[model samples]
Target chain A: MSVTAIRETGHLPDLSRVPLVDEVGVEERSARFQTRSIKKESKVEALRMVLSMIDLTTLEGQDTPGKVQQLCQKAIHLHDAMPGLPHVAAVCVYPTMVGVAKKALGKNNIKVASVATAFPSGMAPRQIKLEETRIAVDEGADEIDMVISRGAFLQGDYGFVFDEIAAIREACGDAHLKVILETGELGTLDRVRRASVLAMHAGADFIKTSTGKIQPAATLPVTLVMLQAIRDYFYETGRMVGMKPAGGISSAKLAIHYLVMLRETLGAAWMTPAWYRFGASSLANDVLMQLRKQATGIYQSADYFSKD
Target chain B: MAGSTSRVPVEKTYKIYIDGKFPRTESGRFFPLEDSDGEVIANICRGSRKDFRNSVVAARKAFPGWSSASAYLRGQIIYRIAEMLEGRREQFIAELHLQGLSKRRAKKEVDATIDRLIYYAGWSDKYQQVFSAVNPVSSSHFNFSVMEATGVVSVLAPNESSLLGLVSNIVPAIVGGNTCVVLASEEMPLCAVSFAEVLHAADVPGGVVNILTGYREELTGQFASHMDVNAIIYCDSDTDVAKEIEISAADNIKRVVNRTNTDWAQEKSQNPYLIKETQETKTTWHPIGS
Candidate 1:
C-alpha cells in the first residue's frame, strides 16, 4: 500500500505530537473520591459478567510457545464452557508464538497479541525493535505490545523515544499497538503521565503498565494517573486512547474497583473493552469466583477452575 | 594596658557534619546563615561535591545493616529519633523561625514533623502486612511475600518545609529499612543539620541518614544519576528539575518519588507503603521438603 494511501485510510488518529499534563495528585482516596457514583449492578448481573480484559503474557510458565498455546486452548475451553463468559479481549503472547495462539483461536475472534520492541527490558537497538514489531504483525498478530526505552525517556531523550515509537507504529500497519510504559519502573506519576502522552502521540492504540518483571508493577495510583492522561489526551486532541493496566493485578475486587474508576473517571464512553483492558493472567478466575458467589449466594473456591 | 587585662570568651560556631565528623570547609570559606529578617544566626560551612561523595561513601558502607535491619528495629530507631526530636522542639522552633516561619507555624511544623516521624515509625512493621501478600500458588511449596527496601536511597528534600518535609520524606524511607543520603533544603539548612544531630543522638548509626546542605540543581543531578543510588525523592517542585532527575534516574532504573504541591498534611494516613513501593519485593523459592 502507498504511504499516502495508508495514512489517509488508517482509522488510527494522528496522535503524534500530542501534549499531555504530566503532574497530578497521587492520593488513593483522592482518586477514588473524585469519581461520581453510578447504578450498582445486581448480583445476578455481576455473576453473568465476563471480564475479557486479560493478557496472559506474564504467566510464569507461559513464556514458551507451547505454554502460550496451552493457555489459548484453556481460554477457548473456558469460553465454550461458560456460555456467559465474556470473550477475553486477546491472548497476549510473545511474537514467536503469535501464530500458535492465532491458529488455536481460529474463527474465535480472540486477538493474537505479541510483545515487541525488545519487550520487558526494551534495551535493544531501534531498528531491530522495529523489525521485531513488523515480524510480530506478519505472524498473524492482531495486537502489538511494545516497550518505551526507559533509558532514553529518563535521559531526556524524549525525541528519540517518540521517533522510535512512531517507527514501530508504522511497522505495525493494521495491527493495534499497545505501548507499555512499564510504569512501575518509571518511578513518579509525573513521568508516567509524560510517557503516556508520548506513547499516544507516537500512535499507541493503548498505553499499558508494567512488563510484569519489575519490582513495583501496576498500582492503582499509577493506573489512575495513566487514565487521567488518556482523558486529557482525548480532551485536547479530540482523540481517545485506550488504557490497559497490566501486571500485579490479580484480585476480583480490585479489578471491579479499576472498572469503577474507569467508568467514573472517563465516563461510559471508555467502559467498553475497546478502550479499557486488564492485562492479567490470574485475575479472570478471581472475577469468575466472585461472580459465582454473587450468583449462588455462597463463595466458591478457585478450585472450580484448574489450578494449573 | 588596663583594657588588655580583661577578655571575654568567644562563642564557637557549630561545624558542618560530613562523614561523621564536623568539618570546616576545604575552601576555608563560610556563609552567614541568616534568619528571614536578615539577622545572622550562625555560620555554616559551604559543602562541595567532595563532601557529597564522602557522605555517599558513608551511606554505602552503612547500607548492609541499615537496609537489612529488622523492620521492628528500624521502627524503634525511627520512633526514638521522633522522641528525641520532640525533646528538642525549642531548637527546631528557633531554626524554623530563623528560616522564616512565624512562631506559631514553626511550633506547629515542629510538632507535625515529630508526629510524621512517629507515624512512619509505627508503620515500619505493619505496612508490609498491608501491602504484600502470598500468591496462592498451585505448587506444593509454601509461598509468601512482602516489600523489601531498596538500598542506598538518595533524597532531595522539599525546599519549602525544610525540616518537616525533609524528615517526612527521609524517615519513612529509613523506617522501611532504606538508608538515605539527603540534600538538605538550601535556604533552611540549620534544622536539617540539627535533625541529623538528633538522629546521631538517637543512635541512628553513622550513615543511615546522611544530610548535605548544598545547591539543589548542582548536587541533586549527581544523586539522581549516581549508579550507586537506588531511589530518589524529589521533594521540590520545579518540573523541569524533576524531569531531568527522573530521566537521569533511568540510568540505573532507580525509583523516583516526586512530591507535588498537594497538601500531604491534610491527608489522614501517611502510610509508609508509599516508601515501601519504591523498593523491590524479592521473592525467593526453595523446595519445602528436606
Candidate 2:
C-alpha cells in the first residue's frame, strides 16, 4: 500500500488511516459538479445562497480603516435596490481591523472574522501566534481564520502543526476557529487530506482552502478533497465541520458550482452559511449582477455595483 | 477521371468570435446556410441572446484599455488589420463567392473593404483635429471640445454587403478607441467570420471587435436594449424593427444611428463623420493664468 497507517497519539487519529485521495476520481467528480444546470427560480435562489455564504474579505497591506468600513457597509446592504436580500455571513479582515469591522457591522448580525497566526505564512512563533489569535478574539472577532504551518507540515512535523492548531483553538475562547490549510503550498492531494484530518482532530470549526495570497488558491479539486475529508470526519466523529473555498472565486457561476458540490457531497444539511462559506469579496458584486440580470431579463454591468 | 487521385476537403466549422477566440454559441445551436438552389452550403452558429450578453461583457471589459489607448496606436492597429485583410484577400474572395456572389463582385467588394479600412486608419488620428473646436468663452478661460470614444457600440451589419458593410461599421467605432459587438449579415455571414480571423491576426486586442452571426429579429432587441452598450447602429431598412429598436433604446437613452437605405458601396459613405457618430464630445474649461 502506498499509504501506511501512522501510529495514533492520544486523541489524534492515525494519519495513514485517512484514505489517500484518488486524484483522478476527485478531479473528475469535481468537474461533474460544474455541469449541473441551475436555471430560473432555482438559479436566483442559489445566487441568494451564494451571496449569503460569502465572507466579504480584504486582507491587504494597503487595507485601511476606511476600506474595512466600506466593506462592512457593502456587507450590510448588498444592493439596496434589490429588497429582501440577505446580508453576508461575515466580514473578514486583519486582526487590527477586526474592531473597526465589528463596530461598523454592529447589530446587523454580520460576523467579523479575522485572519491571525502570522497569516498567509504561519511563520511566527507559537506563543506569538496564539497571542495574535487571542487578540483578534478579544477584539470581538466572531471567527479566527488561522493558517496551518505549511512549512512544518511539509517537513513531516504533523505533531507540531496539530498542537499549534489545538493551542489556537484554545485561545479562540468562544470564537470559531477556521483552519486555513493553504492547500496550494501543501503540494499534493494526499497531504491536503491528511492536513484536513489533522485540523479536524485538532478542533477546527471550519477547514478553509486558501488565504487568498497563493497563486492557485481555492481550486475545485482541492476544495473537493477538503469537503470529502469533512464528510469522513463527520461520519467518524459525528461532528459537522464547515468548508470554505476562498480566493479566485470571483464569479457567481463558479460559486454556484461550489454550492452544487457541497450539496452532493455532504447532503442538504450542510447547505447554509453555517456549514459553507465563500471567502471572497469580489464574488458579492457578481452575485448581485446575476440577480439583477435574472430580475430585469437583461445583462448587467459592474459600474452600478458598489466597490468592495 | 480514372487516373486522378481522390482527396478529401476539410471544411471549416464556422463559429462566432468572442473575446478573441472562435467559440461555438453557448446555446449549442446552428443554422444551415443554403445556396440559391436550396442545397446546404455550410452551417453557421445561430447566436443566442446569451451569446450577445456574453459579447457585451467582453466589449465592456475591453473598453477601458481600448478607450485609453493612444490614437496613434489605434491608427496603427487599424492599419495592421487592413494589411492582414489585404494579405488574405483571396480567402475573402473565395468566401464571398461561396456565399453566392459573382467572382467579379467579390473581388471588387474585398478591394473596396481594404480601402475602407485604410481610410478609417488614417482618420483614427486625424478625426479629432477635424471635429474638435476651440470655443470663445465669456471668462478668461480656454474652452476646447474634443471627440472621445463612446464605451461600447452594438452594430447590425447591412445584409446587402456582408464584408464591406461589417467593416464599415466596426472600423469607424474601434478606430476612435471604442470596442463593439457586431451582428453580421444573416444571409452572407461567411466573410464576416473570415474578417474576424483577420482581426485576430492583426494587433487588435481581444474583445475590441466581437462578431456574431444570427437572425436580426432575435438579436436586434438585445443589441439595442443592453444597458452596457453606449450606442447602437442599425443598417437594415425594416421600419417596424427600427421603431422597436428606437423605443427599447430609450430605456438607457442609447444613441441610435440609422444607416438603413444607405449604399455602403458608394464613395460618399466612408468618412470621418461616421467616426464622430460613435464618439462623445467632451469640452474642457482650463483656467487662464492670473
Candidate 1, position A187, lDDT: 80
Alpha carbon deviation, residue B285, candidate 1 (Å): 29
Interface RMSD of 1: 22.8
Error of 2 at A80 (Å): 0.9
What does the lDDT come to for candidate 2? 0.91
Output the number of the lDDT-best candidate. 2
DockQ of every predicted complex: 0.01, 0.75
Question: Which 10-residue window of candidate 1 chain B scores lowest in summed lDDT?
Answer: B262-271
For model 2 chain B, give the 10-residue run with minimal summed lDDT.
Answer: B1-10
Q: Rate residue A163 of model 1 by lDDT.
A: 79
Report the C-alpha lDDT of model 2 over A1-308, residue by residue, as the tens digit: 11111111126678988898899999899999999999799999999999899999999999999999999999998999999999999999999999999999989999999999998898989999999998998999999999999998999889999888888887887788899999999999999999999998888889999999997899999999999999998888788889999999999999999999988999999999999999997999989999998999877768778886
Candidate 1 to truth, TM: 0.48
Clashes within 3 Å, all models in order: 3, 0
- Residue-wise lDDT of candidate 2 within B94-173, one digit each (tens)? 98988889999999999999999899989877999999999998998999999988889999999989999999999999
